[model samples]
Target: MSDTQGKDGLAAATGRFDAALARLDQSLVELTNRVQRIKRIEVDTQRLVQERARLATELDKTSARAKRLDDSAHDVSRRLVVAMETVRAVLAKTE
Candidate 1:
């Protein structure tokens, strides 16, 4: 080939290479951004999971306390009924 043709060919090849490099750099930047977003999402998910566990534990304790209170109320009601019956019986005897 002539020298001018060779120079033109080299210049075309260099332009194509530069374009490809630019595309590669752009892709790398996009990939890095995506990875950072994924990391943030992972951290948020972990935080939520921890919060859920804490709430579950709190719920369990509350349920246990409620059950204890309910049992105590039933016991008190039973005693009150017995006392009322006893008082009625005593009044009847007096009469």
Candidate 2:
């Protein structure tokens, strides 16, 4: 090949190589950014899971407390009815 033709071919090859390298670098940057975003999402998912467990535990405790309160209310109601019945009997005897 002629010297001029060879130099021109070499320059063209170098330009193509440089363009390919730039594209590779851009791809790497985009990949890195995507990986970072995925890591953040994983961290957030773990945090939300912990929060859900804590909320579930709290809900269980609240439900148990509510059940106890309901039982106590029933007990108080039964006692009040018995007291009223005794009062009525005493008032009837006097009448």
Candidate 3:
């Protein structure tokens, strides 16, 4: 081949190589950005899981307190009923 033709062929090959390298760089940048986004999502999901666990603990504590209150209320109601019955008996005896 003539020297001129050889030079033109080398230039065309170099241009194609540069274009391929540019496309590869762009793809790498996009892949890096996607990995960053996935990491952020993972962090957000962990935070949400921690929040849900804390709320569940709080709910369990509230439930236990409510149960104690209900038991105390039931005891007080029973005592009141017994006192009323005693007062009625005393009144009947006095009469």
Flag the better candidate by TM-score, 1 or 2: 2
Model 2 lDDT tens row, 2-92: 9999999999999999999999999999999999999999999999999999999999999999999999999999999999999999999
Off by over 4 Å in 2: none
- Name the runs in model 3 displaced over 4 angstroms: none
lDDT score, candidate 3: 1.00
Lowest lDDT sum, 10 consecutive residues, model 1, at 83-92
**8: Cα error in model 2, Å:** 1.4
Question: TM-score winner among the candidates?
Answer: 2
Clashes of each: 0, 0, 0
